[model samples]
Target: MTALIMIGAAVLPSLILLVYFIFGDRFPEPLGGILGTFFFGVLTVIPVLVFAAPLTEVLQPDLLAPIARAATEGFILAAIPEEAFKLAVLVAFARNLKAFDEPMDGLVYGVVASLGFATLENIAYVIGSGDGWLSIAILRALTAVPAHATFGAIMGFYIARAHFEPARRRSMLFAAYLVPMVLHGLYDLGLLATSYSGDIAWIVLGLGTLIIAVVWALRLQRRLRREQQAMLAGTAAASLAAGPHELRG
Candidate 1:
């Protein structure tokens, strides 16, 4: 029963966020494509775990002091690799779908991949807690799960815009990777630093970073949604004027 509770606590948050992100899409992507993306998203965990091993060994590197080494763990080691892999999956797998016609699709699929990774990641974290598993599970459900979703939302916003705007592709792609990477790194750093210093302020910094990220992503999503709604209206108008049977892509 405890094992089941652990799994539930881990899995439920991601599922809730996944539904929240995708449910509002005007034209949804196929169920199979979404599932496949989620599958690949879950697979991203393997590489992240493998990469963390080497970084752990180098925790006391010669060039950097322990403090600096600790700092780099958040931004350099954790953020960069994790965001890079998630973005790769977004581009290679999610972007290629026939239905990825608008910015919304990018946002939707981004949440899918991120949540998939979150669900699996959470299970491990919660289950490993041993005695205080419930607290860990609840805390992460509220914090980590939402943080990841917002990150994905931010990534998808820029990448999807890049898809439709060729002139700004270079900058868009740069923001797509960089914004989330920085946010993620900072969030991790707050937690890590708190561990070392025993400062509750570090927890505030981390949660503050997450709250800011969430707000930014929500605003971006709303703006994107409005833009797409206008596009839909225009397309519908054009289609009706053209003829009844004239299909629009």
Candidate 2:
């Protein structure tokens, strides 16, 4: 029972986020594609572990000063590798999934992919806490998991635009990788710094980073939604202009 409870708490946050993101869209994704994307996301852990462990052993981030350590761990050790694979998975699914028909699909798939990775990562983290696991679970549910969601949303938005906007691909792709990379780095930086330095200010910085990320992601979602609406309206207009034979409606 204790083990089941532990696992449940670990998994619950991702489930809630997944459901909420899917329902928030007027067109929710098909179940099989969502599950498949999530599964690919979960598999990203394999690459992250393979990538980060060797680098950690070589760099020894723990021995560095708090701020330097935070930067190294936050960006080099965690965020870059994790986000790289997540983006890779998103790219793969975007090419393969038929449901990925709009810019909003990018946001949705990006978030779900991040959630998939976060779910497995969270479970490992909570279970690793041993008997006193509730705190870990609850704290992560509130902060870390949601943080991943925002990063995914932000990354997905740009990557989707990059795909659709060939002329803007260079700039859009840069934002896709760079924006989330910085946000994830900053959030981890503050948290790790606090842990190492035992400073309230460090945590404040970390929490503040997450707050900013959340706000930014919300704005990105709205922007993507507006673009998607315009695309749909344009398509409708084009079809009507083409005559009744070509109209999808």
Candidate 3:
């Protein structure tokens, strides 16, 4: 009974975010988004579980002692498998979809997929910890929610750019994929550092990364708005110019 409650608390907020991302947009509607997000979430867990052992073996030897010590249970145990799984899910399920219509839609769908992943993942974490509901709720709200959302938003931004600008699609795709990896890597590194050094600095670094990600996302939104406005203005101007010629013809 207690465990179920704890799991619910952690998972509910993430679920709300998922609902908003799916239903809030003026796109195809909630059903497809829900299906996409949920399917990706379930599918990602398979590879994560299957490759867990090999990934640990490969990453463990190469990692620095401090980081290794921090991840003594295993580096891939927490970081690589989870991140790779999320990325794969996004790529497989959401990318190249026609429903990804507007630039901001990238952010929306990516976030929905991520929230689905986070919800299940958080439920697992809370249930495993055997911690009280309050702790689980607070921890997920503070850490997991933003982290997953940011990663998805980052991916979505680049995916949207790639879709819109065919000439620069490859570069945009690269940035979209690489940026989230860097953010995820840095976040894990910070956790590892904190464990080894017992320094609060690592926590600060992780929080700082989240802050930076949010700021970057906001800037992207604003930039997209400006670009959209410019496109609309251009279209209107072209239409107006063509009107005079049509009358003469």
Candidate 4:
């Protein structure tokens, strides 16, 4: 009962986002969007474990003891694997989707995929903690849920540009992947530092970084909207200029 409550809390935010996507005009078909989110979420975990398990074995006992000592369990156990998984999933599934028509669609799909991951992850955490539901709920709400969502948003923002703008596709794609990598790496590093030093400052810094990511995501959203509007306006004008006979609509 307690575990279910915790999972509910953790899943709520992502589910809210999912609802938004489903009802919103910007998203693809409702069924496709929902399936896309679930499919990518499941697919991401496999590659994440594949890469992380070997890395953990190599790093923990054999090499770089000092660095290992400094690193938080979360860094080795969660951050690297999770981020890599998200990237792999995005590349494998999202890049090929026809729904990726506009820049904002990138953000939409990215958020969906992230939400799927967060939902599953939240369920696992809630079940494994064996703690009271409230505690687990609070922890997941404060940390995991937002972090995963932000990571996905960052990736989606850039991917949208890469898809829509052919001439700058390479650059956009690079930035898309690179932005998330840097942010994810910093998040892990900050958490590691905080755990090692037992310092509130490192934790504060990590929170600040998340705040910045949010701001960046909002700005990108606005920019994408403006660009999409402009494109539509231009298309409308061109059709108008073609004369009434050519304009079937």
Q: List the residue pairs that clash in candidate 4.
A: none
Stronger candidate by TM-score (3 vs 4) = 4
Candidate 2: the clashing residue pairs are none
Model 1, 91-208: lDDT tens digits are 8988888888888888888888888888898999999999999999889988999999999889988889889999999999999999999999888888877766676778877889
Judged by whole-model lDDT over C-alpha atoms, candidate 4 comes out at: 0.69
lDDT of 4 at 211: 75
Tell me which of candidates 1 and 2 scores higher on lDDT. Answer: 2
Between candidates 2 and 4, the one scoring higher on lDDT is 2
Q: Assess candidate 3 and give its TM-score to the true structure.
A: 0.78
| Model 1 weakest lDDT span, ten residues long | 60-69
Clashes of each: 0, 0, 0, 0
Using Cα atoms with residue i matched to residue i, what is each candidate's TM-score against the true structure?
0.90, 0.90, 0.78, 0.81
- Cα lDDT tens digits, model 2, 117-227, are 999999999999997799999999999999999899889889888888989988988888889988999899999999887887889878998999889877877776677
The sequence of per-residue lDDT tens digits that candidate 3 reaches over residues 1-249 is 877678678877877766654454433334775577667865666676777767557666445576565554333465556656666665666765666667877777667666767777777777776546587678678876877777777777887788778999889877877787677666666766786778878877677777787677667656766766787798899999999999999
lDDT of each: 0.86, 0.88, 0.69, 0.69
